[model samples]
Target: MAARWLKVLAAAPLMLSALTAAQPAQALVPYVAVPAERNLEGAGLGIAQAAARLLRIGQADDAARLAALTVQLIPDDPRGWVLLAEAQLRSNQNEEAAVSLAKARELDPKNAGILFAQGSLALKDSRPSEAADLIREGLKLDGNNAGAYFDLGNAYILMGKSGDALGAFERASKLRSDFWEAINNQALVLYEQNKAGEAIKRWRRVVGIKDAAEPNLALAAALNVAQPGNTESLQRAAKALAEDPNYVLESWQKEQLWGPRLRSAAAQLLAQPALKADVERAQANAGASDDLGDG
Candidate 1:
């Protein structure tokens, strides 16, 4: 059956053209080489694999085009629709991605991944309540997804449920021990909740796990607040700013979901006269990047 469909699929374009050019009366006659259902599904899966490869290679536009074709070939296949939705998301076609995800959910209502994807879209759309609910539902179906829990924590943070957000981040970090981002978020919530020492401890641990800019700067801020004019904190703050100047900008920190309390601490750390040169350089770098983006 698969072999027969492969042959038919290979000749499909020619057959379609021939049928189009046929006489009206002949065209109306029934044709009998219909593809078997299983064969079509196999073909769709094959195409989906190709699309996945394209997506992995950074050819998001091509991947989306192929995934669109896959869904047309197997409209009932939830996997095809999910692939289409992912490609659409990569291309930043959020509305179309949402529609594709909805179609996939209709095809496979029990698919936890689809629910998680929808929840992520909702979070991007700033509907935190809806995002939380959808993510919770997905977790109910499959609770082991560390990334899903991380997203749930972000949603809870947006909803101002700091305690819930902390728990969610803790769960994510526990599920994946090397999940520094989740651990870092737990610090954000902790600091917002007035647990400064705990937040500082987590931030230090995050820096140990990964010498990334966010945790480094956050730790610096916490230390500067706890111990004024600390040399190590000032040095780390300078290094972090040099590494990723965007963290110097309040807007960027807010985008990273840094709570008000943390942001205030960072502002104080950045305002230090001892690190005047570092702050100026970071600000200049950030401004240049902003200008380049505008251009």
Candidate 2:
């Protein structure tokens, strides 16, 4: 059955294209191919598999709905519960996700994916010790889980183990080069280690992959200090402020993403006449947009 499924998956792209061509006026949407229950043997497995594919494609709400039906269809299948938890987590329904994960763990205590999700929630809740332990155990079970390593790095960062955090982030990057969060955090670790040059390099790499406002903001501040009056850095700062002015306001707080020293540095950069002017314009625009809603 696995071999047959693999063959079907290999042919799916071409088949999908032909199907799309048959309906040229409509946008193409990929769908899960589930055989009839008589052919597949387990309807619940087919539904759960579809839910997993939906979750992968950034359709978390749909995935969650399907996964809910899956658990009803096969209450004994731990995978359905785990899939539901993943979708809920993606939707930021933390408390509900925890309940689903708990049920999944009760059904399959050693499931690596359940452990990874539990670790992520623990990290988000500021329980670094528990997160670190759970994520480490999950990694031992699923050595190729890049996201588990990324969470482990976050746990280490919260624990002030910058060196260990760097190692974990590096492993995650090696596994998935496009993991921008890991690279962004790697820059944070470097900045904390007082290696401004290294941090700048990583920040540049991160921005190259995506125009993430946070990394751009951090890079602009670092460049402002490391090479005062650098034109390109000033442009980066302007772009960040224009793209995400709220970051400028929130970044001034003591609890921003960077450390105290970097935050202080960012404060200084934010005070520059040109950057401050752009941020003010952005804030005014946002205020106007909000005011329109009040009518």
Candidate 3:
């Protein structure tokens, strides 16, 4: 026993050096939509390449199947599990997807990969509480985990838990300050909570961050919601709507995002006789897509 202990003690310095030498403080891991296409390192390439190929051919079913198969083969690998979970989600097999993800978590409890999958699954399952718990646990494991925070915020929004969603998204933005999607979603949650001023503030931050037209459209929606009947709000929204390029208005179709409050707001705002001329002028801006139900 003493000899073994001495041997381990002597090897400790070498082990530490190897660990540090192999990976830098922030070494980039091989990952992306097409990992195999690039000369990347690690086990992620096979799954990523396979998924890319399948997606390119519009064979999402086969992609999902192969992704799940990859996870089965690489039980210890987190990326395979993530791909599998994503594929399951794409196929709408959410519950079964969660089960597959549980296997990944079992293999790597400390990894943020499976945690993101689990939280996304819980959110997809309409279990917000579970989703929040899973994602928070993931963030605790890795504070810089972008996917966990995004999915966590997404879960909160799905549950109509605005405060929790905003906090999660804010944490995500803090970690990756350049993530305009986080900012956009955070603003949306604020707007839903009737804090349109704060929502607009966040949206404006997104505009500053990415200068995306989508955020501007969202800002227009927020402006309208905040100052419902004001001529200034109308004009601002109308101008944004007119200047918008993605003619496929997303907010109106994102009913799962808005629910009754947004629907009522849209109906009331659209029904306004005074705003009719501008509404018609910005007719392309009415973005009704999905309907919401009590969740």
Candidate 4:
């Protein structure tokens, strides 16, 4: 009976301490609920991103709706508009995407991310000239806009000016060492200039980057003209043709990239060997003439 009495007395203080701790925890219950509700508020973003990816692979309408929902869910996220713009672009709603992106830019004008989406749309619309202007404006906002630099390169390529394009892409790669887009596009300009060997070298740097089909096509073309060799280049061309059934060697530059009439720049590498030989022969002749003059 004495031991039981002592045990009852100990339980009274212990129960009092537990009640005191519970009071503070109960006060915090509402605070915890607020955050849980907020977290769920924008939770649809995961579904939106997945839907956008499907749209990018050409699901068109489904992607557009998902992007719209994403914007509804997280209107403040600049990325939300970008996702919407990309989906709209896929659905051939260029004007709408452009307007939406302009709003995104107005809200976050200094964001390089928004600039990339805007410029890509411009590129698709055959407005390389206009795209260049937008990217340049983006650069004024942020000098480290690698996406702007890439768009600049694309603009120059459309202008049939590979030298300028190469410089811009080089700058982008330097600014962001991991910039695979700049690297891939740089190879493209190189190939356009008939520097297939140089183009091949550029493509090699961005080998593991995802969705680099054009670069793959370019690599094959470059390798094809690397020498007069048959097997390898043919295989590469075959693969490119398979990937893009309508793939043309210089089709983008000649048709969509440059002028209205679409000039003939088919595999510019074909003339590279001839040009190199001419330059070398001219150098040799000049050296002989110099030797005679010296004598």
Query: Highest TM-score among the candidates is held by which one?
Result: 1
Q: Estimate each model's TM-score.
A: 0.86, 0.75, 0.61, 0.56
Tell me the TM-score of model 2. 0.75
Better of 2 and 3 by TM-score: 2
| lDDT ranking from best candidate downward | 1, 2, 3, 4
| Candidate 2 lDDT over residue span 160-205, tens digit each | 8989999999999999999988998899889888999999899999
How well does model 3 score by local distance difference test? 0.65
lDDT of 1 by residue, 81-147 (tens): 9999999998889999999999999999999999999999999999999999999999999999999
Supply the global lDDT for candidate 1.
0.89
Better of 3 and 4 by lDDT: 3
lDDT of 2 at 110: 82
lDDT score at residue 271, model 4, on the 0-100 scale: 37
| Model 1: lDDT of residue 6 | 49
Model 4 lDDT tens row, 1-295: 3354345344534433543455555465553323233443444466466666667577766667666666655677777787788788877789989987987887788886677677778887888888888787777778887767877887888877778898999999999898987887777666666666676787777866644545555565566554543565555544544444334434433443432211232244323443344334433443354356445
Worst 10 residues of 1 by lDDT: 1-10
Q: Model 3 — TM-score against the truth?
A: 0.61
**Residue pairs in clash, model 1:** none
How many collisions between residues are there in candidate 1? 0
> For this target, which candidate reaches the highest lDDT against the unseen true structure?
1
Query: Which parts of model 2 are misplaced by more than 4 Å?
Result: 1-63, 251-256, 284-295
Writing each residue's lDDT as its tens digit, candidate 3 over 6-98 gives 453455345335434655545634541222312222333454566656756665666676665455445566667666766777767777777
Instruction: Report lDDT (CA) for all predictions.
Output: 0.89, 0.79, 0.65, 0.64
Ordered list by TM-score, greatest first:
1, 2, 3, 4
